[model samples]
Target: MGAAMAAEAEYGRGERATPENWMYRPANGWTYDQVKELVLPFDWDLVDGNIVVRGMAVWWHNRVRNRLYYQLESARRRPYAVDSEQCIVIDDHNAPKPDVVVFDETGLDIRTVVQIPADKAVLAVEVVSTGSRLEDRFSKPALYAGAGIDYYWRVERDEDDLPVVHEFWLHHEAGRYVPSPEQPTHTGKMTTNVPFPVDIDLHSLIDG
Candidate 1:
C-alpha cells in the first residue's frame, strides 16, 4: 500500500486519538519516551481515545492467554505476535486492539517495511473484559470478517462461575462466521477448516 494509505489506515485503527496519556494526543504530542515511561508500569493499552486496562476481573484473562500461548507454541506454529495488544488500524479514524494476533513469522521482521497487511492476520483473539462484551463479541467480529480474517475466538472467563465458557467462531463465508451447531460445549474440542484446518482443545485451553 502507498504511504498515505497506510498512514490513513493507521490513524483510523484507534491509537489514542484523544489527548490521553499525554503522549499522542491532538493538542500536545508527548515524546515517545514520555509515553513509554507512563505505560511501562501499568496494564494499560491505548486505542485511539480509549484507554483499556486489565479489568478488575482479569485473572481469568491472564490464565486463558497463557494457556493459549503455550498451546500455539507447542503446535510448532511460528506465531508472528501474541498478546501484543494489536491495534489494527481499520481506517484512519478508528482502531481496536485485539488480545492476541497470530500471523506468519516472516511478516513481522522489524527491518522490513513492506510487510503483510494487517488484514492478513491469520487469527485474532479477544479476552472478554468488563464493559467490553459488545466490543469483543460484536464489533471486533465484524471488523475481522470485513477484513477477511479466517478465524476469531472469544475467550470467556468468569471466576465467579463454573464451566468457564469458550466460544469459537470460524469465518466460513466472506464477511461472516458460522458457529457449528454441536458447538463444542464446555471442555469440548472444535476443529476449524478456514484459513487452515486445525484442531483446538477448547476446554483445556480456556478452563484453567
Candidate 2:
C-alpha cells in the first residue's frame, strides 16, 4: 500500500507508463527534440517550462486549420509560407503549436522544415476549441508576443458555428497583443484590404 501511494505522487492517477525523472529550466531547459522523444499519447506542448497536454482537435477544428492554411498559402507575399499544426519554438522553455502559421520561408522550401524558429515566424493563428478557449485567447498571445512574432489571429465560432476572425498585432512598446488596425474582427467571412489584401471566405471552411 505504501509503495502504491508513493508511485502516484506527482500525478495521482498516473499509471505504469507515466514518465519519471522530469527536468526543466533553472537547471536545464527541455528541448523540443527531447520532448518528442518521450512519445506521449496525447499531443503535448512546452509551455512556460512545463509540458502541457493539448486538447484533441475535432474534424471541424482541423478543417479550419487546413482552409486557413490554403487561403494564406495562396495570398501571402513572397518569402512567407503557411502550415498547419506546426510547432513554433519561441525558446528552449516555450514552444506552442499554433493551429496555423505564416512563416518566412527558408528559400521556399517546406520539405526540410520540421519545426519553425520563432524569429522566422511572421504570424501565429489559433482556432479556439472547447478545451483550449482560455489558452488560445490569452496565454498563447502572451507567449507569441514575447517571441516577437508581429501578428496573431484567433478564430472562434459563432452561434451558427461559423468562423469569426479576431486580428491582433504585437504592441512592441507594451509587450502585448492589441487589436490590429489593419483588419478588424470579422464574422462569417474575412474581407480585408490592408495587412496585405486577405479575402478569405470563412463560411466555406465546411464541406456541404
Candidate 3:
C-alpha cells in the first residue's frame, strides 16, 4: 500500500479521532510552530480543539489544486486572496481544510489556526476524493452555507479522469446552496462570475 493509504489505515478511514496530547497533536494549546515541527510528512488539522488527521493528497489531487490555485490567484483582485489547503475555522468545533479558499480581507489574523470569519469568506472549493465524497458533497456544503459563505464549488473526476465542476451559490433565506443556472459541463471549460471572475479550462487543469 501507498504511504497515504497506510496512514489512513493506521489512523482510521475518514472518521475523526479523539484529540490527544502528543508532540504531533494540534490542539487549542499547541502553537503553529509545534504543529509544523511534529506533524512533518503528515497532514493534520485542528477541528474543534481536536487534532484531525487528514488523508494525504494523491498526485492528481495536488496537480488540480495547484492549477486551480494559480487560476484563482492570477485573477484575484485586491482585498481577496486565494489559498490552497488552508484551515477555515467554522466555529469552536469545526475547522475544515478546504482544497481552495478565497476570502476577503476581514477578520484576517496571524495565528496558528487562522480564523476566517464566515461572512468574510467569499468562496470555498473542495476537490472530491473517494474517501471524502460524503463530506465534500454534503457535510461541507451545509457547513459553508450555514456559516454564510456565498459560494461553494465541488470538483469531481469523471470516468475519464477529467474534472467535472459543480457550482453552487448560497440561498441566504433557504440556508443552503442552490445550484447555479449554469450547469457544469462534462467537456470544454467552466467559468464563474461570482465572488470574482474566474475561467477554469477543465482540460488544462486536469491533463496539463
Candidate 4:
C-alpha cells in the first residue's frame, strides 16, 4: 500500500484534483494534531487509521438535525453547550464526530481548541444521513461506547418521514451500548433522562 501510494504521488498521473488529506498516510491513525495540520474541511472523520469523508446532508436530513439541536440546546443551562458536526476524539486511532454533541464547559477553552476529548461529551447524537448508514448504525455506536460516552442517540427517518430517536447508554460492565428501556422506538416527542432530565416536543417542527 505504501509503495503504491508513493509511486502514485511521484507520478502525479492520476487526477490532480484530489484533496491533499486523501493522500495522507501515517504509520498510526491520524491524530487530532495531524488532522489540524491538514486544514481540511469540517466534513471528515478519522476511523481505524483511515480518513472518512462525509457527504453533505439532504434537506430533510438537515431539518431533523436542526430541530434536534434546538430542542437540546434550548433546554440546557450553564456549563453545557450543544454543537453540530464537531469532532470528538476517542483515542489515537478513532475520532468520529456525531452530528450533535452535548458537551460541558468543564475545562473547555473557547480558543485554540478545535476538538473535544471523549470524556467532555455527555451525549452524542447522529442523525442518519443516506450516506452515513453504516457509520451511524454500527461503527459510531461501537466507537462511542468503547470510549465510554454515557449517552448516544441515533435518529432515523420513519416510514412516514418523521424522526425516530433510539437512545443507548454505555453498559460499563459489558463495555458496549445497551438500548435505553425507557425510550422506546417512537417519534414526534422525546421525553427522557439523558445527560439530564428533559422533555422535547419535536411534533410539527418538521412541518411549515
- For each candidate, C-alpha RMSD in Å? 8.3, 4.8, 7.5, 4.2
Tell me the TM-score of model 1: 0.60
Using lDDT as the yardstick, the better of models 1 and 3 is 3
lDDT of each: 0.54, 0.77, 0.72, 0.78
In the range 132-208, model 4's lDDT, one tens digit per residue, is: 99999999999988888888898998888888888887899998888887875557788887787768766654786
What tens digits encode model 2's per-residue C-alpha lDDT throughout 1-208?
Answer: 5554454353322222235633222224455555644566678778875678788889888888888888887898876778788888887668898988888886545667668889898789999999998899889999999999988999988888888999998889999989978665987678764335688888888755
- Model 3: per-residue lDDT, tens digit, 73-181? 9999878988888767677556677899999975466564355666678899988877778878987898899889988989888888887888898899999998886
Ranking by lDDT: 4, 2, 3, 1
- For candidate 1, the per-residue lDDT at 99 reads 73
Query: Global CA lDDT of candidate 2, please?
Result: 0.77
Best by lDDT: 4
**Number of the top TM-score candidate:** 4
Model 1: which ten-residue window has the lowest total lDDT?
Answer: 26-35
Candidates arranged by TM-score, highest first: 4, 2, 3, 1
| Clashes by residue pair, model 4 | none
| Model 2, position 200: C-alpha lDDT score | 86
CA shift of 176, model 4, Å: 0.9
